[model samples]
Target chain A: SQQGEEDPQALSIQEGENATMNCSYKTSINNLQWYRQNSGRGLVHLILIRSNEREKHSGRLRVTLDTSKKSSSLLITASRAADTASYFCARSPSGNTPLVFGKGTRLSVIA
Target chain B: DVKVTQSSRYLVKRTGEKVFLECVQDMDHENMFWYRQDPGLGLRLIYFSYDVKMKEKGDIPEGYSVSREKKERFSLILESASTNQTSMYLCASSLLGGTNEKLFFGSGTQLSVL
Candidate 1:
């Protein structure tokens, strides 16, 4: 079963606009990571926020984790056409367990 | 550069036929995984191996099996292919014992079951 559930199944925005995606999981996690997948391709790791860390940033990507609410959010600033892809959030329950991925959010950045 | 290579970019197999998808990672990572990507379902783990000759079933392992005879190689087998099993298969590898280690993924294999 999937541990995380991503909100806003699809999002459309202009190239210069910002995009936000949210994820909610059932159980506690050691960390949360976000990934992006282009059409017909594999996933690429974006950023990871540990349970202890409230927020993290990589380039224009920002990730925030809230353990109390068991949820996380990803924000992509200044979206571009190349940024159009499916974004997923994965949760690791512990160091020994494999990461469980959410369904994902499809983001379309119009040029 | 870290690389995970899938043997095939595209494949077509008839229903009930046996199919094998191979993956090799050059990073010498201790963990390997097989996942299937569908249109609306995102990615679902099929199987994973933490070490050579060790395997574990994931959430959707039915009708599928895996083999990991070597540390850097993982093979996903479809015992009997079905139309419903047609999807994009991805292979990934990661180091062990890290709470937030990033996974390196292959380009993916698009399999079609007729």
Candidate 2:
């Protein structure tokens, strides 16, 4: 069974709009990573947030971790048409364990 | 930059036929993984290897097997392909034993089983 589950399976917005996606996990994790997949293809790593950290930023990507709530969110600021893709959240339990992925949220940014 | 390459971009085979998906990494990373991606199901781990000749089953390992003859290569094999087995297969590699290790992935192979 998948340990992580993402909410809002799909989202659509204008190119300049901001998009946010949320994910919830069932277990404690060492880290949570976000990935982007274009047209249901291979995934590209976006950002990773450690369990102890409340938030992180990488370019236009921002990720927040609320361990007390077992939840996390990814916010893409000033979305671009190129940003249209599926986003997934993967959790690594403890250390050195394979990541467990959520179903994912598909974001479509219209230009 | 790390490069994880899959042998084919697409593959088609009849039911009950043997199928093999190959992955190679140029970064000399110690860990490699194979996963299948399906619509609404996300990516599910089929197998992974930490070193040469070492293999471990992931969440979904049924009807699947893996071979890691060398550290740079990992292969996923299906003894008999089934219609339900048709999906996008992805390969990834990362540094060994890091809590915050990020996975580098290949472009993926879309396999179709008739």
The 0-to-1 C-alpha lDDT of every candidate, in the order given, reads: 0.92, 0.92
Docking class of 2: medium
Q: What is the DockQ of each candidate?
A: 0.63, 0.71
lDDT per residue (tens digit) for residues A14-84 in model 2: 99999999999988899999999999468999999988899999999899999999999999999999999
Per-residue accuracy of model 2 over B13-77 as CA lDDT, tens digit each: 99999999999999989999999998878899999888899999999999999999988999999
Model 2 residue runs over 4 Å out of place are none
Model number with the top DockQ: 2
Q: What is the TM-score of chain A alone in each candidate?
A: 0.96, 0.95
For candidate 1 chain A, the 10 contiguous residues with the lowest summed lDDT are: A92-101
